[model samples]
Target chain A: MAASTIMKKTGAALVAPVGWLAALIDPPLRALQKATGLNGMAAFFLAPNMAIFGIFVLFPLVINFAYSMTGGSALFLSGRTYVGAEQYERLLTCENYLDKRSCVEDLFWNAAGNTALFVLFQVALMTVVAMITALILNRELRARGFWRAVFFFPVLLSPVVVGLIWRWILQRQGLLNYLLHQFGIDQVLWLTDRFWAFAAAIMVSVWAHMGFYALILLAGLQAIPKDLYEAAEMDGTRPARVFWRITLPLLMPNLIVVIVLALIRAVQIFDEVYVLTGGGPGTSTMFLTQYIYEIGFAQLIRNPGLAAAASILMGAVLVVLTLLQLAASRRNQNAGAAK
Target chain B: MGRITLDHIAKAYGSVEVLNDINLKIDDGELVVFVGPSGCGKSTLLRLIAGLDQPTAGDIRIDGAIVNRVPAADRGLAMVFQSYALYPHMTVRRNMAFGLENSHMPRKEIEARITEAARMLEIEAYLDRRPGQLSGGQRQRVAIGRAIVRNPTAFLLDEPLSNLDAELRVTMRAELASLHARLKTTMIYVTHDQVEAMTLADRIVVLRGGRIEQVDTPLNLFNKPENLFVAGFIGAPNMNFFPGQVEETLPDGLSVSFLDGQKTPVKAATNSGAAMGAVTLGVRPQHLHLAQDGEPQIPVQVRLVEALGAETVVHATASGGERVLAVLPGQPAIAKGDRIALSYRRDLLHAFDGDGMRLAGN
Candidate 1:
């Protein structure tokens, strides 16, 4: 067959099933809509989407919870022995919550502590950097597109690749060390020291995600009407005053989103840091996911139950953070909607 | 102290020029309105005066001091935006105080000014509420209050009443007129609505295609537009145009022939150079009357009749497929497809030269 004929045949074949499905599915929907005198058409439209969400999201959530409840080496829930709250108790067994050395699962608690520190530093630093970068980029700058692409490029990289790339740059004989050497400085251990490795991990994590948050913040900045700024300018408002009184307040909702997302992703971080630091330099930079990985699949006998419990706790933390953000966002929206 | 002068001001964005060689002087305590259709650079001209946008090639002076290099913040001018542009998060009190605070005014004085302006605008009840909490009219008042509190040399308003409902707009328009009268600050208002311009302006500057078409008082603009654009733009029901050429330059006036073969000897005072050329004769809808037996007659085919209570605006067609609108007093006995004869005085007719500039004399 000629190319055009083949294309026509392919297009027809692709469209035929969709047409058949529509023909078969539409009548009952219309009938139901008329019979019910309610929003039956909306329900009909939503059914397929809901089913996909349920099968993927809801199904996995249930399985994960089930796994957390069972004390199991087995993958299947039916094959595992049920131990209600036992795994959770084991994970939470600590003389003092803040003291990771006192915990029964010392590595898990250590990872938990490190994750907290990582989140605090990451969220705060990322927000400030992203905000400043967004503001600078939002201006009529030279090579704006190129600068935006440069910032966003790291976000497009896989976490493992990001770790690998940073690992190369932060090694003792890396590009950073070479630059330092050019300044006649001694070679300092970057990844092999406890403090430097942890700091490097945090810095690398921030660099990788700064672009994403900046993009979000940039959108929020752009959404502000130019006339408000003009009005402020005409009102004889200083630049700083305009930002504090208008730009920052209006950007609160988008900022809250960046903060919450950065916190959640910081808690769940494993891949890049694992590849970069190996949760090493004496487990200084190990996080919750790394702890879970070590428990379930790596160094020790597979403790899937404990790992699942730890992960569930992590999920709960994220949920709480999200709820707080949602509340803050709702309040800001209410205030914003009044205007 | 608010006398603003634009000296050969021009603005362009790369190759696209928006305002060109604009020169105008706004006297102190005068409310000059820049009225035109959208994209006529009215707002751009206002921005230039306010020092929000720099003119690409000229000087802007306020109070006889050159302020071309001055930033908008230091220009000491206040502008009320079309959007109100209230700080969405700040209460009305803080919003009005923000500019004063930036100027480092004493807190007591700021409070006093805010209180006085709020009372003046009758918006003291809404001081604690954000702009979002107020109704549209109330928000508009707050916006005006913000400007009033500044007590600057000049006030630039960019269609401040364009957002309100029609009835509210009328009320706000009255308030604005009274406010301008009381304050007597040099105000330059920009609007696309000619009615707002006519009703509010001491002088209306009509602009088209990045150039000022005419500048005159409301009465003068209505009675004598300097060009065809102004004539058509200034009135509600646009002036009727009959395309014709000057047939003779008589000692008294001029003789013109309409395209549809109707010849009328214009009995105006004296003809100028612009009188002898291809011309367009403009008669406002209100000026045309139902012809009596002896007067000059215009044969028209009535197409539409709109009975607007006290008056009926009849949409009709004249010879050569030209559209004619006649706003006659009272509900006339007019209907669709009615052939009628109309008459207009030669003195009421506006004759434009080939270049669209209004010819000298009546």
Candidate 2:
């Protein structure tokens, strides 16, 4: 009995340090050690993601706000001035600015309206087309993989490349005009006209982005259970009615996701319009992004202060829209759970 | 009301045939159950009847009119699925009214039917609730309610109670039976559980590997099984069989020798030559009794005794080394390794041929 007791004591003594080591090495709590340790191993593990996010997102955001208060080039020692919201006042009310001819009343408000129009039309069109395509491709048709690939191939192409190709096709002597000429029709100016240029930008934006929305919507459609459809059939529900009652209601969550994503991407449209129209045709298609770029870089004398103010305002609007979307999504999930 | 007939029905996927030459007649207002083990084509047959699938060769007729080409929505039949399949997004009232609304029924009539169905299912309080808000049993009741509101000519239930708990299944079974009595609509129910088939079916169709093994009333099938498969499948604990051959013949009976070489006379109708061949003797465990001594007694060494309160089961080996079970009433004072004699009533004995067909009785 004495030997057994000694052995038990020795086992406990051996296990104590090992348990301590295990607790130190545990995944969840090891983070605390990294935070408190002098060696900084935890920071080393977290560096890559943090560095990328800081450089691409956080750094620019901070610099934009700081630059909004200084009047000079973003380059260091380029003659700075502490403007104190003066840049925003100038952009909002200045009448003699060289780019002010592009504005109807106020440059900022006109660009905002143009961006809203572009966002509304493109997002609505892309969502409808994407949902319809996803529904059709999700059926049990022959060569389904081939059809999905055909519909989704556009998303793989670079937006710049897509814009350039469509630019060539929409020009006066391009493929569209050539086709029209085959019918002995007069050439229609697609880019020079203000309405036509706006229409062209919206069309190119949808064409280049519809595939991404379609892929997401297709996944959501496939996630719906097939048994529900069979149950609808057994209830003597017609095909159209089943779609409206069962399919549409169940797909609302996915539809909201598609709408929000498309809206976000649509409002930020730059590359395609830049390559195709260059925000021309008397500023009809000049969006907020182009307007900011012209103020910051395109003009001979870069106005970093004004560009920074515009960027901050656009960021604020985007944040508000995103927060509203998140709140709506949360409410929808809660309602679904409550049922 | 409609009478459904399946004539020489066969189903195949490419080269693999799943159901072959199936023929059945479901009379109007009768509840027929298609029961089998898993992957036995029971669900496929139900789908065929509901027009969810078309048979490869045979024709399906409803009320003497061929409906092989009719789509599911035009078949005028309702189905209750095993998963309930109530629309998760719609309230109970909306789910029941959806079909009527699709058919362009007046809004007032749709509301009335929905109210009636909700009242019938005792879910009036839940008309505004979605299926996700209800329990499994309540969801199933809502599914049934959805079907009732359609007022179809027939109802197809595909293992609709398999999702319920055991106690709820029993209660739902009674509820479904009463519902059938009230509606008197032709119902085709499918299940893998024989208890459900025996209790709920007016007639049970036993299927095995895409073929119909037997179709008969539950009691008749229990008492007179056609073959070894039916006999082995229909009973609980299963009927026990011992290998044997005819040894001699008396004026009134034939003496059969057990594998242990003991001969006992059984009243059998087979001639001596016919009975002299290879045979098997079957007796239910409940038929055997512990005897002190008898002319037909066989000595068995008890290996295990299970004393269930109402009955006792003795697992033992005969002197000839054949395993046997004897079920008796009350507890028997038998222990492991104890020797006992077991006997059965002569008329309770069953004889089968080597192929597992029942032999004629005298």
Candidate 3:
């Protein structure tokens, strides 16, 4: 830890000379800006940041779409032949959409089905739990800072680290079984059993991400004016009644944000689940992200076409979610405008 | 039924005390306004009365029952906050219904109460609209309507009209006064606006530094402020003070003059044993005007003249840089840098003793 911290300091120190060089050029840049109008100068200064964003983010996005349309597994688009909608057809044409076994690429359907279930369970349970935690943290409770840090601590951990920590406690000879044995109960296979493994994955995902959403909701809670609660109290509003009538409705906007973000995160979950159960005891714990990874890299036959198509499908799902988020925020804005 | 008595109520947050020995008896069906500068604990006092906050040491009684330990919801009071605090998501209709719903009132009676309140507020047309859709004044009325549906024993309004614009504030003030007259329910209002206090309250409690400076009718507070702070606070175009020390004691009255050796008061009276020493004499701006040839006057050079339509305010400095304001009737054709002589009317003078307390005999 100390060596890493020293390295970070060195890294920052190494950038100072470059910063000085930029400062030297700043005067000439300002001189040029003075000769030009504001829009020209603004675009001139924005060039570097925009170039970086375009290269890193937008360029890859376009390339991913390009890859989805190509047939063979060529790294470069020039070496690959165009398949038009062939890969998309294989994905969309399922004999029985409900049952993945009858689909042309059955594993993709299975992963997609499992992910839908995961998202529904995870988002519902996580939101309720996070909101409750936020409400409690927002109050003047004892050890408030400590409790807040405790809840948000998991979010700071690497996903692999979080998975490793939970894995030790849930394994067959893990701490959980030992505790159950001490309580005079039989040891249950937590990760080996299909139902339990799926449940465990959902539980771990919720535990890891709940704090982040709770922190957001906490901010929303604190932003509410204190006088409202005082007024509600004077109106003879019962505590539970106040929560239902005032707190819940006023917090709906933030809750929408939490749901959208949590849904997106759940759709992309890979690292923690992969480390925890390796997409098994069967395909029960496999997620759509893992399915994409398996096809793109892990399979004996590397089918980049199929993997890219699956990812494109996932991207479409994300777009719909983002649109839902946009609709929700617009509604929230209308509510705010009324206020 | 809504008589409230705060018995030696004192509040302390940790080691810092905000209110000290506050003893007040608010009568049933009366409107009392607590007026003070910011951070004078007026809102804290209101919250204590509403049972929203507990006093560190004392008891609060409503209708002669000790209610210090009773929860806020059991206090049978409604408060209209400065922010209005209306539930934003609920319709105006539902916002008014929330409190009644908590009480398990029959739905028909709740509807009737809501309808009557909405009609009274002239907000019946907007009942279906959420608070976010209403204008500021409209939202304030809905806040009041929500309070009215409960029909609680009393109402606590903490600067309810302060959020409105100037024109709306004046009308809302009249509306609130008429609301009090119609309901005749006991109310305790808190505001820093002395004008709001003077106009809306039957009696005004002037507070300074966590203690009551004086409490009286509006005219009494205006005409006879009890101290330097109240005198300065209770008037617009605020009262001018001339710091003077007692130079002579006569059988009829004592004589005092401005600290700058330019003028002496026509008459200064001291009630029997009241000590005569360093004193500050206060006169409202309206009492000072263009001097007659023979009358006593303080010479001042004008710094600025504000001709505010019906009246003119001459902001000038007396001898030795003492600032004074003279409000003259109608338009006074005075220019900046014009030297002026101002007369002091003996009857309109107020005197504060060395320690800032009002001298009883004036």
Candidate 4:
């Protein structure tokens, strides 16, 4: 019996290795087994990623949609009253709560206009400055690495830190005023004035985000073959013409990516506006995200349904814009490839 | 219609010198080719002449003007790169007109030049197509057409045919030769292939280790190579060398005794100051022949015979432990380990001294 047990154990060890060897020799059968085994294996491998995505992305999105149609305290998960589409209707139609005056202007529409203006100015300014900086850096210059580090350092700073730093710099009695004092100029209230506050916010956004776009543009510039420039040189083509005819066209695909990413990030402007003005010295810096926060958490009367509805509407707009940009990019890539 | 001159051109990057004192004058409408191994600075020299690079010391004159500080665009020259370097985004018409457009040439003149260049290159049908839509040879033709449209004083080509297949390279080589004949412009071509240099060059400049080895016509480079490096590099199945010593100085020639103690008369002038101790006898493979009985012959043990239809190459070892190759007409039936008598014409022999310098006179 002992001898038989030893033989059985040895056979068991040989079987495990032989099975592995057989799997390698016969790929089709092994693939079938792998396909059959994927549910268990995938669950083991992807459980953590799925859990994080579900908690952070899918769960929040579903909860927001559900909460938009219900009337409840965000703190109290249970005992919620279903209000159907009333929250959406109130969000779109109710102007009394939106504006305190007898004036017929809607606060949601105003906030959206502000967000649109902010996105337009910030994205355009950032893209142009970044591309120009990248072009300058791509040239044969002294201390290129040092310049790249200087430009890219701002991208590493947190958005809140950037906002706080710029707030102090732009304040009436702060660094700008100090510099102006040396130059014998008058002090200006940068944050209190609506135009100045908007301009300052846009400038700070461009400053913080310009480095990332510049780095991407720099990569694109570097990818252009040196021989192309040499060929241009041999052709008697001027430097300006080379930039227009070769460099700019070749850098289009990268520029599109930078513009799209900047647009998306710019539309989601929240932290800077929050830290800089807390939605204002008046309503000058009250952006869409701050509006949502105010309705949901900070208002005298907490309107969960209105805030949820606002959040859903904003999310839909963002999704549509992103998809439109992606589709345009895809078409451009196809056209480029076809050529 | 311009002659280019490079007067003592040298290039150095930091401490390491890449090109050292290169001096050559290319005559008007002549095709000069720079041929060398990789990293031999042949391309660097071409770039210097094309004004793509500035020399660290020396001047490059085009049409009697020093273009040392001139940019490549203002130098009145066009270059075709190895990669063709055509704009992938533009149609052929646009690519050819790009330089003219940059110069602010009028629309009508640009179109006229483009049409003329396209017709000359036989690429009229491909004018509307982008470079990516063309074949390798077609793209090469377009690159040439782009240069042709400019009507530059000189043309610079850097291994333009190296990217093509063997058959295409030959076809393009003939095309390039015809192009040069028709254009009649000073063209400096750079290549590492000796066959390309031999077929295309009016005068070939052979470079080695950042220095010029020899500058000569193709036949001259083949027949009268100045040094051991040029002799070995320029020919197929290179010249063979056998070790020998001067036996005695004759009235008309020198009698050299081979390693096997056989004495043969070599018609080479001996330097009076040179020692007659050791020498090397060089002979081309085609000069060696199979000998009959009662002729001056050297016995060889045939190791391998290669039949190449037109000519047979016999690889053998001589009795004195010297390896030799003999090229004979047609196929010769010979097997390994067979003893054969190889003979050669006495006057065809070339004698070199110990330092690889060719002996004078005959």
- All candidates' TM-scores? 0.93, 0.84, 0.90, 0.86
On TM-score, the stronger of 1 and 4 is: 1
lDDT scores of the candidates, listed in order? 0.89, 0.84, 0.88, 0.85
At residue B9, candidate 1 shows an lDDT of 92
DockQ of 2: 0.52
lDDT of 1 by residue, B1-362 (tens): 89999899999989999999999999999999999999999999998888878889988999889999998878778999999988887899999998888889999999999999999999999999988788999999999999999898888999999899999999999999999899989889999998899999999999998999998999899998888899999998888988988888777777888947778776444537677778888899999989999898898999999999899999999877899999999987989999999998877888888899877435
| Tens digits of per-residue lDDT for model 4, A1-339 | 699999999999989999888877788655655876867666756879999999999999998888888886654546667899987876566435545342232556666668889999999999999999999999889999999999999999998999899889988888998999899998888888888988888898898889999999999899888989999988877778889889999888888889888888887888977788776767777778888888889888777777888889999888977997798689767857765
Q: Which stretches of candidate 1 lie over 4 Å from their true place?
A: A1-84, A96-98, B267-271
Deviation from native of the Cα of residue A288 in model 2, angstroms: 2.0
What does fnat come to for each candidate?
0.89, 0.76, 0.82, 0.80
DockQ of each: 0.73, 0.52, 0.60, 0.55
TM-score of 4: 0.86
Best-to-worst order by lDDT is 1, 3, 4, 2
Model 3: per-residue Cα lDDT at residue B199: 92
Question: Between candidates 2 and 4, which one is better according to lDDT?
Answer: 4
- Chain B TM-score in candidate 3, rounded to 2 decimals? 0.96
The order of the candidates by TM-score, greatest first, is: 1, 3, 4, 2
Model 2 misplaced regions, further than 4 Å? A1-56, A91-107, A176-188, A335-339, B239-292, B295-356, B360-362
Local lDDT at B44 for model 4: 91
Candidate 4 chain B has its poorest 10 consecutive residues by lDDT at B268-277
Q: Considering summed lDDT, which 10 consecutive residues are worst modelled in model 4 chain A? A: A97-106
> How high is the DockQ of candidate 3?
0.60
